[model samples]
Target: MRIRIVGTGRAVPAERLTTRALEAKLSLAEGALEAVTGVVERYVCSAESQIDLACAAAALALADAGVEPGAVDLIIGGCGVPYQPLPATAPLGMQRLGMADGAAAAFD
Candidate 1:
């Protein structure tokens, strides 16, 4: 059998926090965050949680692939900055994707 990638998706929060804004909020010197991290802006969760974001992206991926949630066989997930180190992200993603237990294998 040939293994193939069938779908892909991504998601970011609606709220945006710029480095300058963060600096001002933290009362740090101008360009402090940028000087240290070289990051100018980033998305912050306004109402969505990590699961919500992951699920949103996953939903899109499912749509793109034209696959139903039950058709999924596996899920691989990783958090750039993991919130909860325990309970791998992929299973949670599978749950959010509406897959029942044992419906799909998962890995973090």
Candidate 2:
């Protein structure tokens, strides 16, 4: 079957730490980490959970796609590692997306 990605979105925490600040904190030479990693800054999660971030991005994606939650046929979630290691993150994402259980298939 052919698949189409209708939209995309991104979310980041309110707080951010720049590479230079990180370098100073780590006592590394300024610009060293950015030179190697090519990262300018990163968001720092204070009280947000993985699901919270994922859902925020998903909400934007859904809005961008002009699709309602019930219109989704499937939901797939992934991460470098499971955030909590139980009750997989996908179902939570689906719920947060406002899709009812059984409305769409979800998997991590």
Taken over the whole model, the C-alpha lDDT of each candidate is 0.86, 0.88
TM-score of each: 0.82, 0.86
lDDT of 1 by residue, 44-63 (tens): 99898888888999998989
RMSD list, candidates in order: 2.0, 1.6
Candidate number of the best TM-score:
2
Name the runs in model 1 displaced over 4 angstroms. 83-86
Distance from true location, Cα of 87 in model 2, Å? 1.5
Lowest lDDT 10-residue stretch of candidate 1: 81-90
- What is the per-residue lDDT of model 2 for residues 26-103, given as tens digits with 9 covering 90 to 100? 999999999999999998989888889899998899899998888888888887678776678998899877788888
List the candidate 2 regions with Cα displacement exceeding 4 Å.
Answer: none
